[model samples]
Target chain A: AQTVTQSQPEMSVQEAETVTLSCTYDTSESDYYLFWYKQPPSRQMILVIRQEAYKQQNATENRFSVNFQKAAKSFSLKISDSQLGDAAMYFCAYRSGGSEKLVFGKGTKLTVNP
Target chain B: NAGVTQTPKFRVLKTGQSMTLLCAQDMNHEYMYWYRQDPGMGLRLIHYSVGEGTTAKGEVPDGYNVSRLKKQNFLLGLESAAPSQTSVYFCASRTSGGPSSYEQYFGPGTRLTVT
Candidate 1:
């Protein structure tokens, strides 16, 4: 079984600043996918970014980027130039290449301080 | 496109009552999933389907049942609801296999409260 862990329960970042939410996973498979999802007060799950374990180059999407270390089994999401709207509950998820299911972390509540 | 839609956005039921949640997607996805979101727990998969007329149990399928009679729709049913079942239920769908199959599109979610 694969499990994702988000060590930080809550994180706060000032507007225009940068913050990183740490996540780690336990998986025996070498080929898999990692994802970061954002759920605001609206309770809608939005994809922030994703990284393929086989790819060493970090994935960057606009102001969001991920530091994926496959050997360490660590995938962290970094939010830069944070805005108030960026405040949400962030989750880390993992999906094995051979499976259709996704395992998610507990979550990290991100607070953007204006 | 409406993407994905869930019927009965909110519902309240007494313990032992039964209810069904309908999830429909217009993306023609072959794989659909049912998940629950609790206070501290992010999201746990309850059941999923690979295609029409096929369903499989997920991590927390003990108290839930699901059916996928159509490729665009997935239904979750609770024969006897319990307070522990009070949470937000989410529906997701994705391609069966492809470059973008890793991504799952989610619905708005249905909030259910069993007292």
Candidate 2:
């Protein structure tokens, strides 16, 4: 079974600053997928970014980028130019190749203070 | 595109009560999943359907029953609701047959309380 771990339970960042949320996973499969999801107070789960294990270049979405170290089993998300809207419960998830299920981390609550 | 939608944004049930949570998607997806989210315990999959008329147990399926009679709709049933079941439930849908199939779109969750 694959497990994702987010060590930080909560995090805060000043407006316009940069923040990084750490994530690590345990998987024996060489091919898999990693994802970061955001859920606001509204309880809407939104996809932030995704990275494939085969890709050497980390995945990025505008201000959201990831530092994926496959050998270390680490995939961290970096939010540059953080804004108030970035405040949410960020969850790191893992899905093995050809599987439909997702294993998730406990998530880190992010607060962007102005 | 409405993506995915779960009926009854909020629900309350007493012990031993039975209720069904409905999940519908308009993306013509081939897969649908049910998950529960509890504080400090991320989301855990309860059940999922690969396609119409096909369903499988996920990580946690002991207290739940799911049916996917229709390709676009999936239903989860709790025969005897318990206080331990008080949490938010989420529905997700995704297409199969491509590299991007791993992308799953989630619906606005349903908050259920068993008193």
lDDT of 2 by residue, B1-115 (tens): 7889999999999999999999999999999999999988899999999999999999989889999999999999999999999999999999986876878899999999999
Model 2 spans with C-alpha error above 4 angstroms: none
Candidate 1: tens digits of C-alpha lDDT, residues A1-114: 899999999999999999999999999998899999999999889988999888999999999999988889999999999999999999999988887778999999999999
Candidate DockQ scores, in order: 0.80, 0.85
Q: Which prediction has the highest DockQ against the true structure?
A: 2
C-alpha lDDT (0 to 100) for residue B37 of candidate 2: 97
> Chain A TM-scores, one per candidate?
0.98, 0.99
lDDT of 2: 0.95
**Candidate 2 DockQ vs. native:** 0.85
Off by over 4 Å in 1: none
